[model samples]
Target: EVKAIHYHPENTICDCCQCQMTEIGTTIVREEAEFIPARMEKVQHIEHAYECKNCKADLSQKAQIKRGKSPQPPIQRSIAGPSVLAKVIYDKFVQYLPLYRQVKEWERYGLNTNDKNLSNWVIRASHDWLLPIYERMKNIMLEKSILHVDETYGQIINRSDGKSGQSNAYNWVYRSVPCQGPTIVLFQSSLSRARSVLEGFIEDYSGTIVCDGYSAYDKIEGITFANCWAHVRRYWLKADSKNGRIGVKYCDELFRLEREFKHLSPSKRRKKRQKHSKPLVDEFLAWVENSPFYGKNALAKAAEYTLNRANGLKAFLDDGRIEIDNNPAENAIRPNVIGRKNWLFSVSEAGAKANAICLSIAETAKANGVDFYQYLVKLLRDLPNLDIHRNPEIINNYLPWSKTIQAECVK
Candidate 1:
């Protein structure tokens, strides 16, 4: 319920005047200005008339004003500044917000805006302003000694086939040198084939790639694959749900190994695996080889799981450089999945590409220990004047790993 408070002026006698002073009324003043409708009035022009009486002729002169070129009206309708616009775009595309809902929220505030304009701004700004940062991030990722690669399905509308139904697409994210910063995310669209996207992104990247058993990653040449232990354990947990006793034993063993892994830092974990975990891995392998667990009805499942992922599991034991899981890549891709729930799908190929670029910057900023909002604002403000070839430092500043340079210098 809304309530109004009224204040009445108190009547007092002026001692100096020796008369009663009646307070006629009271006025209320507001501390802050309130919003009022814009007042627009039509302007009128009047001409002055002059007469020359000496020449017996009446002359009328019209006012002729010298006018310069009219300045273009500012875009007053925008409640958000360029920085705010960049942030909103990042939140909507990288963070994910449906346009229709954003429109409704703006309407509630007495500001009228359409989702179409916002979408166009996001796409145009991402392609024109943010694409360089995205490219540089990918290049940095390729330079890393270790990387994780993964792909997830992305739905799209208005595909090339002219079909009304949604199309199956993919977002491929790659991160390099994740521990030391400057992580990168690369997104690409593919029908179903993962090899093409992975191969294309990591064409020159030859190093350890941690991934799941997607089979499509097999096509990459000279690249060592380190399988995720989480995937392996997931299978064991599933099997335990059906076959109780055997499943429980395997799950307990895997859980114990993971607990050991959690106690070490990323770098220390790698070294500890070589020291203490190697012996355990050897014993586990020998047990698998000798036990009936590999000979029963579950033999095929156990064999396939052990044989295919044996190298990946042992890689950590042999070299302290490999990770036990492909969690970094999965963590990077998680945001895109959550965003899909809100925005649903991209309208076109271009829109998807834009979404990928914005997400790359946001995620990379976070990885580099930079604020996403501040970094995005800098991108929007400085990108228009940025010359990528000559002014490569601008690109470097946005890289997650490149932090020696000061923020003031980039601006």
Candidate 2:
């Protein structure tokens, strides 16, 4: 498709001939992209009803009336539609736009709606439609053998636990390793960052968990912790001493070896690490144990931290599927962290949970190369029609990696 730029009648005349100039053909001078600002329009549905004439003619007989099937609104008793709700979710979760700001954006589009109405739409949609999908994602994610876990701070303004709402809260993120399968990033909002939080999320599960040197992950039964080497390097990086430099060197060498073996098959990668990385690991641990610094110094602190979690740091050697760092989980959780900076805090605990659900869907869709807005639109439009709660398996068809979903939602 092509668009023509029109000139004024006076300008269309040829200056040299003083005659009218006509377009013989078009020239491909240049090409550029254009953005059209979005505008809103009102949509009204008028369902037609039909009645049997014969039955109507017989006054004693009841008339058979049939009504046309109308499409359901994404949210009942609200003006919001599937596309509208998708935009709100996309702006707030993906673009990090807050509700008050989005209210202003709606005004620009000639729709005057307050932040309270927007919040209600999101909360109701998440509770009614999105929560089922979130749960299904969680169940499938936990089925994978290799998982990465991390957490960051979150706040809520209304308390449910009888404590001040201003008190601290946390958002825990768990994701399946990319190598294992289609990545699933799930977020959980909780009042505590205790080990119990993680334990409850992965109940009765047994697998490798790659994570930072957080003590809360220490000795959870049936779980193997592959502690992050990058975290260990951070301690050494902060230590302002000659030995600290040596510690960093050891870490760097191990990382370099991992990068070289990145393209190898898991079994082959395991072989390469055992042959090359194991020696460096042994040597680095020896250096940390024998370091001269002690008591209140950076070097001592680094060594103590290293030796304490030495086993977990070495756990990656036995399995190639586990990464040398928890960077995947960190990168996954960073969106929420960045959004937290903009939105500030959830108005209530329920709102925080809704935030987690929305973020999970958006991030999971992104990991699978699906357009976030399109995927949300798909879910919001389709899920309402399915008996998702009774037949939970129906959600499997709509997951980010499903064949139909990939074809439909990936851009």
Candidate 3:
């Protein structure tokens, strides 16, 4: 609130020898920010029935009755509205607030709910409305010519294979290069981190993939693999010796040159790398190959790792569009890792899949610079009205980069 004070004409006279006060510019006295706690509201939809008065009076024909249609709920016969469901998911996935903690928060807002009910709402909403969007994003991401891939471990309370609840499951992430295509980050959950998992996602894809030094990616036949130099740098850092310091210097030089070429076009970047970065790469590889590290020490291990992925480490030099590291995929997968620290393992296989679906939607929304909560609310409130099943192409409009989504959900 703002209150302005003015001098009254009657009070303009001075006490003894006074004159009318001259006008002066206003000044800000004080300012402070306030916080308004969240609150909940209940909405009721009432449908009225009516009968034709004339037909009833005539009594010759039966009176016809008409009823109003109530708007569809996200889930039938459920108290959760689109906004409520969006808040639940946004809290868990984006804010990393577990359902049990949110239970207390919801109580503060005048609602008494448990985590079990919250979990049910999330699983149902993801399966019903969000899965289609996830699938659509996967299809569009695969179409890109360049992608970044990485994986981290997740725990499941119950394994589908009848293993112990503590067994490790994998959360695989795939991200697109914004310079080459739309910004998309997709998370996939797998029971096993086998070569088959990699094959399934990039089935017939022959495009370039920027990844870490994971052997699973090496077995794929038709794809071009550009390994991360950041991982190579990590290896040298672990060596912790004079030789390791020298290796670090070489790696740092390449990165410094890349920073200089950051804004260049693909073709120009490739040209600059060939002229400036290629020689440094060649010299580093030769030094690693001939370095006299006796046993399987850290220095020797670093040399072996670099020599093993020599082709991949040099892959970035040939294409300016390919990133020097898989940092994008790593950054995209970090949220799921953090959330796991809070909620721990998922209870069932379906629950695990639901986690992946929500993560994909949340991360993709963020990557495209959209407000995550707004995007979720928009999808839940609007998607049901669109006929995406009959015409699958209709989902393209809701993708994070689409013009419609940009106009409505971008921050």
- Model 2, runs deviating above 4 Å: 8-34, 58-62
Count of backbone clashes, every candidate in sequence: 2, 0, 0
Ranking by TM-score: 2, 3, 1
C-alpha lDDT values of all predictions: 0.66, 0.90, 0.89
Report the Cα lDDT for residue 297, model 2: 77
lDDT of 3 by residue, 1-411 (tens): 755655445675667788666655666666667787988999898999998998888878888899997777778889998999999999999889999999999999988999989999999999988999999888888888899999999988878788788789999999999886678888888888888998998889888899999898795777989999999999999999899999999999999999999999999999999999999999999998887865898998899889999999999999989989999999999998899999898888788899999999999888788898898898888877777799989888888889999999999
lDDT string, candidate 1, 270-370, tens digits: 67766666776676657656655544444446546766777776766654556677888899889888887897888877888888887777776666566
Q: Which scores greater on lDDT, model 2 or model 3? A: 2
TM-score of each: 0.72, 0.94, 0.91
RMSD to the hidden true structure, all candidates: 9.8, 2.1, 3.1
lDDT tens per residue, model 2, 1-411? 666664445477888988888877756667677778999999888899999999999999899999998777678889899999999989999999999899999999988899889998999999888888888888888888889999999899887887787788999999998788899999999998898899999998888899988888888888899999999999999997788899999999999998999998888999999999999999989877776768987888899889999999999899989899999999999999999999999998888999999999999999999998998899889988878878888989999899979999998
Better of 1 and 2 by lDDT: 2
User: In model 1, how large is the Cα lDDT of residue 237?
Assistant: 55
Runs of candidate 1 exceeding 4 Å displacement: 1-81, 93-95, 108-111, 161-164, 241-271, 289-299, 400-411
Best by lDDT: 2
